[model samples]
Target: MQIILCESAEQVGRRAADIIEARVRQGPAVLGLATGGSPASTYAELIRRHREEGLRFGDVTAFTLDEYAGLPADHPQSYHSTIRREFVDHVDLDLAKLHTPRGDAEDLVAEAARYDLAIVGAGGIDVQLLGIGANGHIGFNEPTSSLRSRTRVKTLAVATRTANARFFEGDDEEVPKLCLTQGLGTIGESRQAVLVALGSAKAAAVQAMVEGPVSAFCPGSVLQLHPRATIVLDPGAASQLTMLEYYRDAQALNDGLQ
Candidate 1:
């Protein structure tokens, strides 16, 4: 695990984008994308590069991390629509190649199984982008989720639902109680994983993910076991990490080497 402390949230986004852009430039590649505010800036940065720097994603195949159960693919609040609006529509990515879990499938169980198979068929993800939930959940894998879990339906916690209430006109009741999410085991299979966080609101969760013990209670801590996981954060988010100076020193050394 590598902790990269950036001076600001925009830098955190750019750093995350750097990892993704590098993967896309490496011939044909697969990407696992995240939704929500943490990755919004990263998507914006990628869009800027596409327009201004000639960064192309024509050969990239993308997969989104999760979706709200019962929401149609075209629903504005659904991850399917959100991802397209936020990133896909701005890039040259092939719409046919981008995959998202069918949250509204009549047979949701089968949908989850099919989604997992689809990922395997695409050669798995080359790089997976993630956002640590304020409660330390990744995707919709709430605390106590099995570390070896696969793609499946999950019940969203109260906190998770409340946090997402903004997308549903600030009504927690409007937020779906269930969701479909790629599990830790599935995410761990990626060649690399990049997680970005910002602001003081994320400080405790960031600290727990980076410096705390590996446990199901804090699902994001599973990244510590990943062979190629990178945690990008702004100062506010990294404030609670005990090895703050060490991480900064190590990142400086790594930058010099690069």
Candidate 2:
């Protein structure tokens, strides 16, 4: 795993956007996108690029990682609406190329299977963007989740519901009980992955992901097994990491060498 410690959230977003732009330039990028607070700045930066620098999403194919089960696609808190409002509507991405798992599908299993097929049929994701939950979950693959699982509906852990309640007017009971998320195995199949984290609240989760043993307890740690995974974090999020300065300097030297 490679870690990039930025001075702030904006810096993290800019660096991540640079990497994403470079990948998109190589070819049509198949992006596995995540939603929530961590990615807000990154999405904003991408929108800025589109508006000011002629960056186009015309050839980009995007698949969102997860969505609340049973929520209407047009719901304000729905991942579909969030992505549309924050990124999709701001750019020129092909409407047909943007995909999200159907949260309200009657045949959820079939829908999930089709979603997985769509991702694989696109030659797999070129870059999967991730955001870690405070409890160390990624893409709603909560603690104790099977690592080899596939795309499916997941019952939200209580901690997850509580953490996500802020988006639903601080009412935990109103939060959806289940969600459709790509399994850890599916996420690990991507050619590359980037996890963006910020703030002191994320320090422990970041530390667990980067420094602790790879276990189901911390789904985010699965990134350690990926050949090309980047963890971009601000100083506050990197606080719990030991030898952080050394790692930062090493990354700088490696970039210089390249």
Candidate 3:
């Protein structure tokens, strides 16, 4: 695991985009994408590079990490729409290559199974991007989620629902209570995992994920088991990590090695 701290959210976004652009350049790559306010700036920077620096995504295959179970793909609050509005629609990638779990499947269990099969068939994700929930959830895998879980429908925790309420016009009741999400094990299967968090609001969870015990209580901490996981944060988000200085020193050493 590696921790990278940036002075500002915008700088973190640029740094993340740089990593993504480099991955996209390495031939056809499968990318695991996340949706939320946290990744908006990174997508914006990617769009900017696509426009100004001639960055191209023609060979990339993208899969979204989760989706509200009952929401239609066209719903404004659906991850499908959010991803399209923020990143996919602005890029030149093939629409046919984009994937998201079927949120409205008649047979949800089968849908989840199919989603897992599709990911495996695509040769697995090369780089999985993530946004840590304030409650330490990743995708929709809330507290106590099985570390070895696969694609499945999960009930949203009250904390997650409340946090997401802003998207539903500040009405917590409007947010979906159920969602389909990739399991921690599925995310860990990716060759590389990149997580982004910002602001003091996420400080505690970020700390727990980085420095606390690796348990289901802090699902994001499961990243500790990934072979090539990287946590990128703005300083405020990284505030509670006790070993922050050591991380910086390690980064300096890695930079010299590179």
When sorted by TM-score, best at the front, the candidate numbers are: 1, 3, 2
Every candidate's lDDT: 0.93, 0.90, 0.91
Residue pairs in clash, model 1: none
After superposition, which runs of candidate 2 have C-alpha atoms over 4 Å from their true positions? none
> Which residue pairs does candidate 2 place in steric collision?
none
Error (Å) of candidate 3 at residue 244 is 1.5
Q: Of the pair 1 and 3, which is ahead by TM-score?
A: 1
Q: Candidate 3 on 1-258: residue-level lDDT in tens?
A: 888889998988987887888899889999999999778879999999999999999999999999998888889999988899899999898889999987888887888889998999999999999999999999999999998889998999999999999999999999999899999889989999989998999999999999999999999999999999988899989998898779999989986897
**How many residue pairs in model 2 have overlapping backbones?**
0
RMSD of 3: 0.8
By lDDT rank, best first, the candidates go 1, 3, 2
> Candidate 1 has what TM-score?
0.99
Clashing residue pair totals per candidate (backbone < 3 A): 0, 0, 0
TM-score list, all predictions: 0.99, 0.97, 0.98
